[model samples]
Target: MQSTPATTTTKYPDKPITVIVPFSAGGGLDLTARSLEKLAPKYLGQPLIVVNKPGGAGAIGWGELAGASPDGYTVGITGIDMLLLPLYGSAKYDYPTALTPIAQVAASPMVLAVQANKPWQTLDDLIKYAKKNPGELKFGHGGVGSFPHLLGEMFGQAASITIEQVPFSGAGEATAALLGGHVQLSFVNPMVVKEHMKNGTVRVLAVTGEQRISDPVLAQVPTFKEQGLDVILTNWYGVAVPKEMPVQVKNKLSEGFKAIITDPEFVKSMSNVGLKVEYLGPQESQTKWLADSQKLTKTLQDTGVLEKIKSQRK
Candidate 1:
């Protein structure tokens, strides 16, 4: 047999890059990804494309990105649900661990909101009613096992009530459902519900974070803990590639994204849409992802969902 020469691959961004947004167009994640798209080519010297792969509560698109070649040409935009999906057996691929953390783009915690005409004025009122009539009240989310889903479960546990859970595709849909009286409440990120809230279509009850969000629309709403509920959660969105991506490619993507996140125009755009600006480079993102995942896993284990998921996997 004749000896053959070894083949070497060229550097990334050698051609067009595809950035996948695992949600519908016009949503918070899609908007941020598109905003980054405008500035990324300036930094990387190559054309970037935004592809929407919305379904399965972001699992369908995430799986597509996971199976893509680890050449750094394919990347994805994901949110907090990426951390909770697998624990509920919804994701087709393991997140956090399967995706290489390039850098965080933006993050915002979920806020509990009710229909404008609903009688429950405060978080306490809602809890009291739910306890009196367990499972009579419904709370909506982006989808089953999403951030809102977990938040609903946690609140139910804390309040000692049974809350009927309703899942939608995104916050837009969830907002619509809440307004249309399909559901009584939702724990949605303020970014997605800002417009409806401004018009008084939906009423915010309380924020789910440790501190109250700075948005003027939510200035009156208090944190869940401040209302006597110890529950705390955050919704963060970030960009990532396959875990096996080249280090140089990851570094370039991280620097570009971090730069875009801190850009004056980008920050303004995100803030206008109610997204809080918080940039986490690769190392910090990885550390947080691991720690958050551990916390979520423990929650699942306590709920008996982890063993249920493993049994289904087997």
Candidate 2:
């Protein structure tokens, strides 16, 4: 009898995996990725390296991720900006088609915040004032095509108010501008303004999620729906690999990330930074990405932003 040759199965991640973050280091997304870096290795059986490739309002880094080899070794942290970038004619690749969703990690609702001394008191007060003084209220946001900017537009449309917008480099800069009174309002993350809230330097009027947030500082802050305005914008973060990644490799990556996002310590760390762990598996992530993209596309179109971007592209 002839002896059969023994076969050995190759591990999906025998080498280090690189997780790209499309934001600058020390930012919320980067911090979240760093947190996962510490936790993923225990489940992945290999080290996870976080690389920051921030530029072009996250278009540069996300485009790189979309174009990377579909071997599952390279993946990235993507957010709502990824969906907005292409609508603005700024992204090099389309999402879900250029990249495969692995899993959603965290989500943070946008807060309609003002300087603590502003005296708006409530979402109704702010809208009433904006209605009386159209375009007098200047709102600061991260940039032109960012989620904050979109939320600002949505707020204005839903409330039938016209307000000016001041675009800054990033949320930190926008928050700084708001603090200095350069802008009266800002749609920022609760975590970004939480410290100020504790010190009574900022007052969050309302959250832009479908439901009220559970954060202690924001527990009293009602949602737009609760305030009688139909607006919901959640900034979500997720992991995605290049399109066409092998099924087994995708499953392995998804499993590792699901474990990391749901781990108690990991969840606590993310919460400390104002991010809530909202894990969505591959199918759910993809579905949400597509749905959000469609919704935002219609918003841009209805608001004339899509037309403006198209004309600019020409």
Candidate 3:
């Protein structure tokens, strides 16, 4: 009798990998996903197909990502929302462990911005005025419980000021509200205020990063700490897969993403949009995800936002 030949398993990533982007098609996350797709064939040896799953304020997409099979084929972009949904008690799964961050791809810190036409030439001016006027000043944010909103609350707490928060559908609307003077202030992306910085339309008083940002336009902005308020929160995006993929497969995907993000062309593309190519490997990425989630939980609790979110869910 002839000996039977042994079967061989297929190599990891032999086919296209699907990356779910839980937002609209034209947003910054979508742009980053598509931009990475351009370099995937070279670095990943397979294409990355980005699927938009926009809804539920990112809950719909994040839910899908958390539920995706543990196989390496399906991954998704995870960020602040992924970490916050579970805390809000709206998530279908516990984000802290259900998903594993493969790597962090990009980041952009929020800036404390006011219309240049306003009287607050500096953060001090804004804080002092808010103190004197109490809740007279209003600020617009992407949405309730969003990073911008929570960061705004944190800032208010740190500065010992009282201000009203206006929640919009998203950052774009909030930025527009700021520009139209519907709100006296806003926590906006450095990029959102970048163009206006040139014409002196929007004045960025401080950035929400531990250190200053690198964008020529935004670098001039001091950090919250530098300005005497220790409030800091960064908007970051990273690729995440279910926490149960094969170790080798996870490592391979991490390597691919790292290569794509580090590519000079990719770096340049991100820079052009005023986003930094902030890369962290799989282990480091997962650690950062966990840390950010924990920190946000504390911030929310301290600012009464945790209870606020819980109360709203009912």
Candidate 4:
């Protein structure tokens, strides 16, 4: 009888993995990628290399990831903006379909805040003032189709108020405009304004999400739903590779990220940066991505943003 040849099982991630971040360095997405870089090695048995490909409102990097080989060596960190980009005719790749979800790592709720000296003390106060003032109140957002812009629009619609929107280059610039009194209010991540809130430079009126954030600094802030406005906006980030990667590679990547997100130290570090740890596996992330994409599409249509985009395209 001939001796049977021995089978060899290949180990996944025998080399460094590249993680593409679609935003500039030092941004939340980049920070998340960096954090994972530190923790992923423990589970993946190899270091993670983060590459920044910032441009076209995250299209450049995402497009690169979507077009990369499905060898599980290249993955990316993406957020809701990836879902909204195609709606605005700005994306080159189909989201959630062009990319395979590995796992969702972190989520942060947007906060509606104003200068500390502003008269509005609660969500009701702001709504009342805006209702009476109409376009008199100026609100700043990161950009035209940014997450904060969408949240501001949704808030305006829910409260039946007309407010002027001032778009800035980024959230940091928007927060600066708010501090300089260039805008009456702004919607931004709590982390962006947490220091200002502590110093009494800014006051958070409410947070946008289904429930209140658990952070000590934001525990007292009410949700939009608590104030009778049915709006939930959360900036979430997840890991994904080019679609059609081998199942074994996909499973390994997912398991590695799940481990990183659940690690005690990693969770604490995320919370310190005002990011809430919320883990969702591959299937769940894909489901949420599709649902959110549909919801945002309807919202843009209802708010006439879709019409504006179409008109601009012509």
Number of clashing residue pairs in every model?
Answer: 0, 0, 0, 0
Candidate 3 whole-model C-alpha lDDT, 0 to 1: 0.83
The residue-by-residue lDDT of candidate 2 on 138-230, one tens digit each, is 999877777888888889989999988787766777888999999999998888888899999999999988888888877988899988887
TM-scores for every predicted model:
0.89, 0.89, 0.87, 0.87
Query: Among all windows of ten consecutive residues in candidate 4, which has the lowest summed lDDT?
Result: 1-10
Model 3: lowest-lDDT 10 consecutive positions: 1-10
What would the per-residue lDDT of candidate 4 be over residues 190-241, giving only the tens digit for each residue?
8778878889999999898889988888899999989888778788989999
TM-score of 3: 0.87
RMSD of 3: 4.6
Q: List the residue pairs that clash in candidate 2.
A: none
Off by over 4 Å in 2: 1-12, 311-314
lDDT of each: 0.80, 0.85, 0.83, 0.85
**Model 1 lDDT per residue over 25-47, tens place:** 86677877877787776777677
Cα deviation at 305, candidate 4, in Å, is 2.5
- What tens-digit string does per-residue lDDT give for candidate 3 at 181-269? 99999887786678888898989999999899877878778999998887888888889888788889988988999999999999988
* Candidate with the larger TM-score of 2 and 4: 2
> Where does model 1 exceed 4 Å of error?
1-15, 303-314
